[model samples]
Target: MIERPDDAPGAGLSFDYAGFGRWYDSYRVEVLDPALVEVEAVVGGLLRDALSERDLARIRGPVGRVKSKPRAWRKLSHRRYVDRIDVVDDIPDVIDDLVGIRLTCTNRRDIDVAREVLDALPVADDGRARLWLAPDSERDYLDRPRPSGYRGWHVNLGLAVDVGGSRQPVSCELQVRTLLQDGWGELTHEDTYKKDGELPPLVEVLSRRMADLLSTLDDIAEDLRDELDRLDEAAVTSAPLPLTTETEGPGRRAAQAADAAAYLGTRWRALDRPVDLAALAWELQRDHGAEITDDWFGFGTFKRFLSSAVPAAEITTGRNAYILPADPVPEDDAADDAGADEHDGDVPDGDVGGHAESDQTTRHGTTGQGTAGPGTADEAEAAVPAAARALHRVDRTFPLLGHDDWTRLFDHLAEAWRRTGAQPPTDRLARRLIQSTRDRSAASGPPLAARHVEAVVRDLVAEGDGVPRPADELAGTYATLVQQRLVELRLIGARNRNARAAVRRWIAF
Candidate 1:
């Protein structure tokens, strides 16, 4: 019988092929290698195509990899079969994560969205190409996390591929997690610590603490997204355009700005990430003197322009990465200031090269002519005190921050009140700002730093007057006039026109 079975598959009669490394290599080269690429491509394409452009922008990566042969061998070696067999013959049964996809998104919402998309995907085989999707392989790890504070959604897909002229089922694990969760996992590598042995007491405690904090930050991100959604709905329904003006010149400018805002709002609404379009339009007009007329704001032109101009939300795994909710637009160039409020109403024409109209202006000061020119005027303008520049930047950044953030900003402003060399804040908002700043200082550890004070001031100026609308409309009209008193004291300075105007506008609000 032995002589007759000399050339049989498992002729050597050992399940552990310790000396059959060459046969394993032959199997890898002949069968597994080609199938790896096919399986990976099919699975990866299915997962990546499920999300739209907007969702894709928020997520970081959808990386894919195939399990290596040595790892597969180690897995197979751990198994004890009832009868002797060839290692290559048993490779298919033991390997599960031979092909894998790891999807890392920016936030919790995206991870959830991915989960839904994967659940509905149809699985297929290579040769006969049968299309079928079977359930019961997914684990909801986010909802039911491990005792070790690990959180992610794991999906094991059983796929069949044509390997060596036969249909073979391959198991692939797909893991979905937020960027933050993935970062934590990489920092405290489980293989290095957990797999090695029992965790040390201090390391265990720190890991739990880190997990809790990251989880809280994730919750905060989710809440922030919800708040933004509420804000967008409010903006579309009732928030009035901020471009109110009566004079023909200002009114024309206002109309142009409104059109631009409307266009942007409509486009973003379709993607479910609407911004405060009115606020954005107002800042572009008032700060940079941008001309958002029909020629420039047309569908074909504006969409392409905004895609490049508007900065996207920067996603990161750190806590301090939030640099205000919206992107900041630079202040207007001097050339644009030369044609301020020009009543010609021509809707100026060109290739629409820049956001603001370009022209030559006298530099020293405002000319007797209606428009200001470049020269010493621009030099003087540029030489405005650092405080004014700082304030302008703040206004640009914070014009639409929430009311609570503004309140915290007011507290900081009061702490720096003495530094401004102006009369102590007497108006209700100013007094409240100072009082709150003091109260917070008393409660917290230390007074804010000089840079922080400047940041807070800019945020206050950016906010202009209220959380959404004017203070009276949003907060029932406060009695204290903070910015009005500051203007009366001339603390904002007239060295910079934009800064001075922004301070006055806040007073009006």
Candidate 2:
């Protein structure tokens, strides 16, 4: 979709610097230097904002620079249709046409981010941006690599701005990347891999190996950076400790210790005081060391210890844990209660109260009637028969319901429960309805249909009934119900559907 200018060779006029430099100097001062200065300032400002101080410090020289060189008349002179001298003299647009800017970055990812940032910037009236990953007009050393074997990201941008009241197109190349990659590229450029000729087989192999190593190093560095961010987030919410040092230590080991201590301290502070501070300290040290040593601790030893040592009520992850006042009823439950009250006198049959319904159901089919009003028992039993008929009807109507149709049906059931006094026949009935709706919807059209079912499942599991579950046990129960329904509907194939599984699958990693 992006329209690029045709760059076929010999399509435009070229000029010899020896003859044109003198004549062009008389008419127009070289403006490429000033344009480059402007680009450098912009790029440096962007880098400062996007990168941390440590990363910024490592960058060598200016982030970007521009260069201008006149093409040889012989190279530029060839005109399939016109002489080079005539082409230059007749074409007034040839002056100030050749310009380039090179940007150097620390790593490939950084280079990508930099390119995105630059492309997002407001463009000049006549400027267009283009990127070249390897050697091209801007950088031509890919075939003949440098000794150090560094590769850089380069961009050739053409400016359409009018200079000195003349309508002329100018080109600038921008290069970006990490200091390490830049260093490697520079070394390779200077040493063995200049553009003179084809490189030796040994040099080629070595260059490729070095390139792989550079990529691996970058990946490792990025992972470390991500871990550091996680540690920082944990640290901010932690309580200030009297025994803790004000200055955090350097490297991964120290970061891990600080993060562990901070996490434990924050979580434990909500409990009664005179806490086992020494034990906490020991746990932090042990866990921190274990992460680095990897072999020091058994798989779940540290986790188990932390869980047992801390108060279950105080320990929270993935979701918040707050104690609600006793008898605190969730809004949806309250709504359900209010709805149930409206149908109190209208009990289906054998209904002593709503509490008895949950007691009758078991993993295996054993139906013992709880204390329901004599009037409600007949209706409740009749409702079950009606639900069975409805399920049979749905099965016949849609033989192979996909994911989305099943979701829609379940949504319909849930809405029906809320709006009307109709209760689903059983949890099994609700599960079937969900699956049938989801399947029908998926079979309807686009590939996103299945994804939509997944989204709804995720939302239900994450924030059930749009109310926060205060206790882990309560949350786990609701999560399990949702997971069970999803599995029954074939939306989520069975593997693991425990508390930890729910957290890992639904919550953002």
Best by lDDT: 1
Off by over 4 Å in 1: 1-36, 47-49, 77-86, 123-135, 164-166, 191-202, 232-241, 245-509
- Cα lDDT of all candidates, in order? 0.43, 0.37
Instruction: Estimate the overall C-alpha local distance difference test score of candidate 1.
Output: 0.43
lDDT of 2 at 463: 43
Tens digits of per-residue lDDT, candidate 1, 242-327, equal 32233212233456545555554454434321123333333344443534422233322222334433335321112111112232
TM-score for each predicted model, relative to the true structure: 0.43, 0.38
**TM-score result, candidate 1:** 0.43
Candidate maximizing TM-score: 1
**lDDT: worst 10-residue window of model 2:** 362-371
Count: clashes, candidate 2: 52
RMSD of each: 23.0, 21.2
